[model samples]
Target: MNDRLTAAQASRSTAVKATLDYPVIDTDVHVNDYTPALEEYVQQYGGGELVDALRKVLGSRFNTRSNGKDWYQQTLAERRYNRTLRSPWWARVTRNTLDLATYTLPALLAERLAEQGADYSVLFPNDVLAPLGAGRHRQALHRAINHYHADQYSKYSDRLTPVAGIPLHTPEEGIEELEFAVKTLGLKVINIAGGVKRPIPSVADKYPAADHPEVAKYAHYTDFYGIDSEYDYDPFWAKVVELGVPVTTHYGSQGWTGRHSISNYMYNHIGHFADGSQAFAKALFFGGVTRRFPGLRVALLEGGADWGAHVFTHLLDRWDKRNREAVHNYNPANADLELLENLFQRYGKDLIKDRTLDKSTLLLDSLGVSALPHSRDPNEDEIDDFALAGIESPEDIKTRWVDSFYFGSESDDRTVASAFNAKLNPLNAKINAIWSSDIGHWDVPDLTEPLAESWDLVEQGVITAADFKALVFDNPYRFYTEANPQFFKGTAIEQKLSSSHTK
Candidate 1:
């Protein structure tokens, strides 16, 4: 037994120990069963040329030759374990013992929750959005994926809030899916890619011959492109605010322009999101979406927070000037300022005093700063581990070792809170930052480990406890629930033990 214990222990012991009791709500994690899930939906519904293209793309990634099995069979065998593990309604109905053990029964997640004391967790689909947007799918295929995610939510309840995936080929179709997602699936979040195909101009506008210089330039930039445009998204955003659902852009793995010229994978994928998201945010702001539907909220997932801060400041500066110019435009004839002053005398107080207006302003203030957790690949574990532990003063330990499990304790001990406050002070107290452990991504280890590491950073004075809480619990809770109050009930954990419970 002693020899076996020694053999079982390896170099990863310290790394594992350091993360054993960190409380966390992993906002990003994935489960991929792409080929089978896509194929089954396609085959059962209808397989057209688009379906064929989907098969070819997915087959290249998951299908193998040695087995000589059909794509569905091979995919099923490979992904059966993960599929069963997912807390989808099918799993619940079938009572897959493995899924029940791992996800549904709360045994697997609860163990981690108990150790780290995590209050809640939100789940996003890996196979759905990453591939769904790449090609066109039959309407039925879209319905199947949507239904599958809905089933996941029904089975797991708050433990997994499945984000809905929309087919963006047409604005009408996007709206339809959005409606079903909220009404049928009870989906709180909607995920759309950074790209959508633009509409063609009318025949009369086809002007100069096909070979015209202007035509060539236009085609090079906009022709047959599958990039998402802000104009096309107006209707969708309108409905989102009406229904009170937050719109999220999950950065797709594939590049938008084309595969060849793209240099770094991260830069290509994340760069497109940054460019697209910035444009999207600008359109919503200037297009008067925020002004129109003041209650609406938008979240940029996996996109870093620093960029959001930069963009908000830039927009405020620009808007202030633009508003001033607009006032000048209607000046003397209408006496714009005096007219506004007269109007203000009549309605300004009423408008400013309205509760809804106040709420909308607050909502915009919160969304002006969005964020994702700072992630370091597990390969850099050593540096991160050392940094976390080194925060403790030797003399402090003489009294009692700090309990890293408690949220915000590390931040308080190491002055991390003060630093975060100072950095965010310029945003006019509109710091809508949240902490997320993009856990379950292949690059990240189990959730608890990172939470422990974050605490270590707090101890080292890298981040504060209040900021840590905001990142991990408070911010996400407020963003998901407050932005759209009806969708999420705060996280609740219930435990059930079997008559003959076993570890």
Candidate 2:
């Protein structure tokens, strides 16, 4: 029965692939690292003590119960007592044991690519991602994990490629790891955290985290790399563009704001990645990263594409109402005080008959002086908030938003239609939505299910044939190749990419 089920799954996806002339590039396929082997490398870098510490503090590197102390180990009462955010359990596929093996074994994954209907896949490595949460030992652990993945997956470069995790807590730190991961280790792709959680200035000034860990955890803000960061991250971004790599982030916003439900994991999980992606996108757009580096390509993964389109459309809507010229429509200085008073006298016979109210109070209220006596309006230079974004027209927003960013929509996300809806998007622009088969995770369950699932969108006429091709192939191709022309150099899809005029 299991054999039949597996065959049926593969056949469906394979049939979907047969309809496409272009090769499908699964941009966000996940893979796990063998924990025991990964820990050996971690020990090599941070020693036995580090391994023992991680085991006690984080459980084990890839263990489902690992990473956090509160949720899994704690009783329901204890979880409630601490307000601990629920952690994920059974994140990997175990019932489909072959699919489970395929994630850890790169060679096996490469061999099974045809069944999954992907010619090539960019692997998001669980081990490469493991080190970033190791705190003080992260820099060393990152080196350990990167080296491990390079050793394990380099041989399977033809079909499967793993992304090296670069922690950008600081720009210098990120550049150092990127240098090793790409230049030294020859890893082609990289994934970065969407934002860094930093201590709020007022809170950190009074209560140091070491002195007050519980107090400090909540007293923090996320510094989305492009905006309001303590240190300028331009050096890191410059290095990224200079290195010919696209900025891809798989960050999520769990335990952030409303996502901190203590018992239900799904409560914390739903739309968290989208929230993180939106935060990152807003920062990049408003902070002038897109304006400064027009060629920079950023892919926000697993959030789906609708949010990007929503942001784009809203930017146009906001700019229309609040551009440099339109904003003056609400200026208090432009209000006719005499006309207002005459109208008030005409309309306020009974309302103001008994009152001897000062007319200047009305003027003060109209000028907004009565409400905000403390903080005045911003400087002339600061009046235009969109100045940093350099959005002079809708075209500018389209260029900056569409050309600079790609959204990763997983197979089952119906909201992906927003990406291809040219009429709905601002300036008739279609967002660049890449196909991401989030296999090996709990959401996918079966490795062969994604391509067929995505194909169903096309069958239902939710998106056209060309739109489906763009989602599955062209967008992913452009996302990688435009960032680095040689991104697919030695891979199976390299020839197909070079031969096509798809970009």
Candidate 3:
């Protein structure tokens, strides 16, 4: 075998050995574009020219060009923001290549599991959710994508678990899609964009609103929103509690327009997109979704963890004051405080009250946060310190900074080995942190580097090996399966895989 292959095998063997002891499950991995497989479905159900136009627009925004010698591929950034548009040579030599399947199923999955030593990898589509919020043929597009994914999941049932995507243009459609994903596809998880895009009539133009109350019924399938919110999602909280499904949201593709004057410029700005994800998530948390559904577990993907620590603390303080002020405003004779306390007690009865919020008078407890480890790509080197703050309180941010550093390294051996060997105090609640590879994006293809980097953190005494395993495996399995017993059962996984492949 080649040197690279040999190293990869060794890594896989090591991962398997580790998992045999701890049972590692990777919560966030991805399956890239299945357009070819779903072409038939698209032809039958998909909108034509508009979809093509959409693809062209998105592709132009991110696609890269290769030089004639096949030696170097230039990404969108390298094109000098489309400097090629002015060149006559561009049309002849430059072709926009958007290859979603750079990492094929069997090969990529096998390699990743072997490299990371994960027992199972929860797979999602890299492009699907981001595009749905555009509100054009959202339902049909989602159906076609899910059908394609279901087929792939069946093909590699042994290693891959697929989370189906649901369209939420209408509340009823969201509910229907959820039922279908769980019952027919056996999808334990449903991937949702945090906000829905609906056309709103205005004096000048019609635009989309990120937060909409009508979208909440879909929460019955999963409580997670792409962004965190306090208002306009109460029905969602109610349904989530009733159904008991944890929500997983990730950062990518905001369904927004008008931020940039240039259409192409808006699409190319990664920072703008990240900001939108952060903003939407903040809105949800401060808006009180967690307070409403305290039992709910929300997992943020791609977006790093540092901001979560800062935001959670800030929100808690705000809510505490809000509760106290409300109490003061009530008349003593009316027993307003007592009535409010009784309601709080009633809500607490159903919510999983975390110790962090026990002393606070606010109704909602703090939900946990998961961090995405830094990318393995040497080109992408900067690790955000903000993510490291996620595991600790805001006051402890400085003293506990070391812990965050230890937890988020890209080296798997250092992170996992050290975590395994470390003497962890049970009082810390086992970190409740997990790693998502953000695979299938145009950028990240393999888990080897990220997993290895995480391990390096462990080996360097940054995080304990136990925490490494929890980040990679244990927590995700518990997160999805624990919320809904029927969805995560072994039979469901196997049956879903079998059915998809047979098609």
Candidate 4:
């Protein structure tokens, strides 16, 4: 064994004794891309043209290229950013995670995980996230990436479950890939981009006018979430329910407006994932996607649990302030015309002569007004308000939001404690904050330290043993099984379960 691996294992032994014997299921482990195999899959799947297009748009190399010339790859400024004062000290302190073998070899990863005190991990692909930038060939490229993952990582099924990448540029394309990835590939987990492309013709003007006018007719930028979305993704959400596999997103909002500056990498990196997760989640809730398909569950990956708490509280707050009866305060139809006329007479100098209020031709009084907020008369049987699903109480909002969403959090985030604190959430509810061991990433230098870092919360009295158990094991198990009851069927987790089925 390598010196680092031995040290990692030794450290894990000390950490595991802190918590009760609960099987850890890390929902956000990542795997390095096997480029040659991915390329082969593209060729076999008749996606050679798509690959060539990707090479032209992005640099040809699959893994991150350190040329210092390519803008998309780490530029000199970004490299310097990683090396300079605060970033450099942080990097040096964190252990080396770039070693290819540590991530590429499944057996090594399994051994490393065991030494880290984790019983199981779900592997996600890094390079596959690139296809979201492509317009024409995204679906084909995602298919190749998914097939490659299934082909490469199936052997590690005992300890690692690989996630299938599915692009959501189009609902039809998403459904097709969903079926292929789940039924055909036998892959269990699904990862979709945080946003989707606007359907053709409607969002045409968002594209650059000069380049490929045909492509320009379609939206080049991705829609942040489904709220007020031009294209309805209800079909895709329904299809996911039918397929019985949960969807997750590790997408980020860096390189976009607020995070676009190149001078500081930290400026772009910090909270980028949370920004994306928040927008996507809020959109899903306000758009009524959760209401339409009650069984649809999504986990936003690697973005900490604190944001989930914030979103849940804010959704309930909005529902309270903007529900049908409450919204009448803002409705023009409910305005007291007589009181407004009296105020205008008392306060108006220039408007009284210019706009004469003839009781015979009073414009405000003459305007058509619905007694109900959204065209439904209050006297009728049903009220058609802005909130379509008729969220009667705050508990309804809490139930819908909490049930439909799960937040995947890194072990080290200080804010993760908010997820466990009922006082911090709406309706005194607990948000689903599943543990994400981000083992292969730079944030966790030593793979074995994640469990130790997470236990710090319990040590500090921020959360309880029950909260830690749910965060590390129960929540993730429930999310995966909510989609597929057989998710832990033959895995080590199944054997550890006191009951045959997941609770």
Worst 10 residues of 1 by lDDT: 398-407
RMSD of each: 19.1, 3.0, 16.4, 6.4
Q: TM-score, each model? A: 0.57, 0.93, 0.58, 0.80
* Candidate-wise lDDT, in order: 0.46, 0.83, 0.48, 0.73
* Reference-based lDDT, residue 436, model 4: 90
Overall local distance difference test of candidate 3:
0.48
lDDT of 2 by residue, 1-503 (tens): 23323444556799888777788999998888787987897788779977865555355542323225645687777777777767666788888888888888887888788898999999887556666677887777778778888888888888877888898889999999999989988887789888888889898889998898777867888889876778898888888888998878887888787988887889989999999999998899989999998878999999999999988888899999998888877666667878878877888667678876456666674456554464666567867768888989989989888899999999988899999998988777999999998898999998888999998988888888899999998999999988899888888897665666565
- TM-score of candidate 4 versus the correct structure, residues matched by position: 0.80
Q: Which one wins by TM-score: 1 or 3?
A: 3
Ordered by lDDT, highest first, the candidates read 2, 4, 3, 1
Backbone clashes under 3 angstroms, per model: 11, 0, 45, 2
Model 2 residue 49 lDDT score: 76
- Model 4 CA deviation exceeding 4 Å by range: 1-9, 17-19, 47-100, 199-221, 332-386, 498-503
Quantify how close model 3 is to the true structure by its C-alpha RMSD in Å.
16.4
